[model samples]
Target: MTTAGGRPPRRLRADARDNRDQLLAAARAEFTEQGTHASLNKIAQRAGVGAGTLYRHFPTLAALLAALIGDDVDALCATGRDLMTHPDPDEALAVWLHAVAVHATAMRGLVATQMAALRDRRTAGALAACHDAIRAAGVALLDRAHHHGSAPAHVDIADLLTLVNAAAWASEQAPDDAALLARLLALITAGLRA
Candidate 1:
């Protein structure tokens, strides 16, 4: 944002910052309950703001999701980086995959949203960056596993993530099964073994 003179705008005013924070908090809750297609008007209502306020802050659903998940993405990437130094490449990859599954499951319908955003040119920037970061992190761990002869050489990051996303979706469908996510991840990791 810029001032009328075209210089960079100052930090958000206190009230504006509070509104943004409230919207994000409400959005997180709504998304958890109703998935990515949750009503924007409902999110605004939950945040005690008008729909226009939400639009002003986040022009698109992808932008809102990017802001919402940015922290988790950063943490996931950081975990992957830290795991790079672990002595057991196979174990590291498995652990990271588990983490990814948990993240995907926690976000409800995130996999679909991410895939849609990646395919849409209008959503090319923020959401694409999030997807790219996740891909990079997973690829690093996957490459290490392949080099150690634990993962199949033909399994690329896209395939792995798609499989993981399916597992996440299954986990969502069987929410009563507490062990479903872990079990699915185990099967996936085992299948990766050559």
Candidate 2:
């Protein structure tokens, strides 16, 4: 089938599709246990596929992460879209940012990889697309907030995302603190208000 870009999408054979699915499942488990730096070979072995097969399916760590987290990113963007109709723009933004942070924390070391993908134009195609979706979502939320005058005119979407990512990273470092993310978000939003 042709994609929106007019390029025909590659269709895998049934066996290849099975192998890819297994690799993705194994990669998800390994990434959850060992963060983004999980061993590719280990994932391949766990999937009962060779390293070559894994490489064929996912050429890079960023590609693997992008495949694994693509659905979550879509959901986050959907949530952002839903919040556009919220009664309070500031609260909608705050809530959406919190959701973004929570999504980052859920994937353990995802924030760093996502931030890197945002900076690197040469990242895997899927990763780049995910970052684009995230950026668009953030921009939409920020636009809503700014239009309502709840956010300062100078508030930058990139800066807000970076702050949320940093908070998620900090929360990961302090895994024992159940409320660090919330506390950090509170401080961040307070600073925005100031």
When summed lDDT is taken over every stretch of 10 residues in candidate 2, the lowest stretch is 107-116
Superposed model 1: Cα runs more than 4 Å off: 1-10
Local distance difference test values of all predictions, in order: 0.86, 0.85
Candidate 2: segments with Cα more than 4 A from true spot: 1-7
lDDT (10s digit) by residue, model 1, range 1-194: 78789999878889999999999999999988888668999999999999999999999888888898889889999999999999999999989988888788655866445754585656658878888899999999999998975887888998888888888888888879989988988898889874
lDDT of 1: 0.86
For candidate 1, list the clashing residue pairs, or say none: none
Clashes of each: 0, 0
52 in model 1: Cα distance from truth in Å? 1.1
